[model samples]
Target: MPFTLVLPDGIQYVGLAFVSTIWLQIGQAVLVMSARKTAGIAYPRLYAEKAEEEASFLARKFNCTQRAHQNTLEQLPAIYTATVLSALKYPVFAASALGLWVIGRILYTSGYMTGEPQKRNTRGGFIGSLCTFALTCTGTYSIISLALAAA
Candidate 1:
């Protein structure tokens, strides 16, 4: 409720954008837990284990979980930027794109948990990537058009 006062424009969509970020963070936490549990190496043991040798079934699953999270981390900034820009310029499209990205990420995570990153590409990871790309392109166009109009 208070957030509306601070962010007057597209409050609902902005809130959804914030929720998307929270979702990503939750995904990261879930992945960390999955990795720890799958690897059968908790705390110090997990930290002390060598990263290079991940031949064990559990280790592989843990790696997949970690990689999925890492991939998300890599794309998070772009997601945030695109969401913000699109929200400001085109609220409806922003919401749709952000929603797709969020949903796709959930599907991607589910596929990743199967211990096959390749499977993720076929499932939702590719779709998520496409959605994120669309967001970025839209945001770029919005910024450029707005800047040109201002000039």
Candidate 2:
């Protein structure tokens, strides 16, 4: 029988960028638990060997492994913004965007691993980034508005 999948190995972080942070955390764990896969993707050693492959081409040929890592690293800023903003303006919207973005990142990462990074498979991730940017702005505006009203 197929067991139901658990969020973050069994617990959910609720709907928010928390999920992406959780995943990025898992990526951290993979650094040791599955170090081979993590490092292989994070830093491709044979750029010339796999210059023709989809996943490695970006890392080896173009020398954009830093960019790949950057994409993973970018997950947090949005999540942090979402968490703080949600706590302020509309918690629900912030929460929802976080969840969506996390799910998007998963799709984005998985797609990048096997498919073309330039394809629609990773679109959700960029959209998630946009969501994060929007949520943060909204929250910041709300905080400023509240301050003005109080003043």
Candidate 3:
């Protein structure tokens, strides 16, 4: 069953971004599960060993999925922080950016699973990372500027 969300007017876009964030997480988890299943990697240690077998189709795909998920994890903290700050200050823009990020991630996962290496560099994953970078930079700057001004 799919989950549903309904937000009030004042926080609508923020709510949407939050929902999208959860969806992104869920999507990544699904990729991990798929990779694990494909590679017969029920154990983490086994996965660690087998994940290096790029010669095998399942292993290669699993490694790709794992890498994508790891990359997302590395970026998620900053993205979430930026989303919160942007939501507080500019809900609509934040939502738009976050929603696009989610879409890009979906494309990234799809491409990676299907052995589309260029997707990370020439496609959706790269575009999503750019969005995350922009938002993180802007949010950090905004916060620091506000702090400096107050001080």
Q: Report the lDDT tens digits of candidate 2 across residue range 11-124.
A: 233343465567755763453234234335444442323533445443332323323345667657656755665546566666666677666765565555433556424545
Clashes of each: 0, 3, 0
CA-lDDT, candidates in order: 0.74, 0.54, 0.74
Pairs with backbone N, CA or C atoms under 3 Å apart (clashes), candidate 1:
none
Per-model TM-score on C-alpha atoms: 0.81, 0.58, 0.77
lDDT of 3 by residue, 41-114 (tens): 66664243553565577776777787777777787788888976665555677778888998888788778766
Candidate 1, superposed: residue stretches over 4 Å from native:
1-9, 42-55
Which residue pairs in model 2 clash with each other?
16-98, 16-99, 17-98
Tens digits of per-residue lDDT for model 1 on 1-151?
A: 3555344356587677668768777867777686777677666543324553355767767767776777777888888888778776777778878788877877787788677778777668877888788888888998899799999
Instruction: Evaluate model 2: give its TM-score.
Output: 0.58
Candidates in descending TM-score order: 1, 3, 2
Candidate 1 accuracy as TM-score:
0.81
Report how far off residue 136 is in candidate 2 (Å).
2.6
Q: Relative to the unseen true structure, what is the C-alpha lDDT of residue 115 in candidate 2, on a scale of 0 to 100?
A: 33
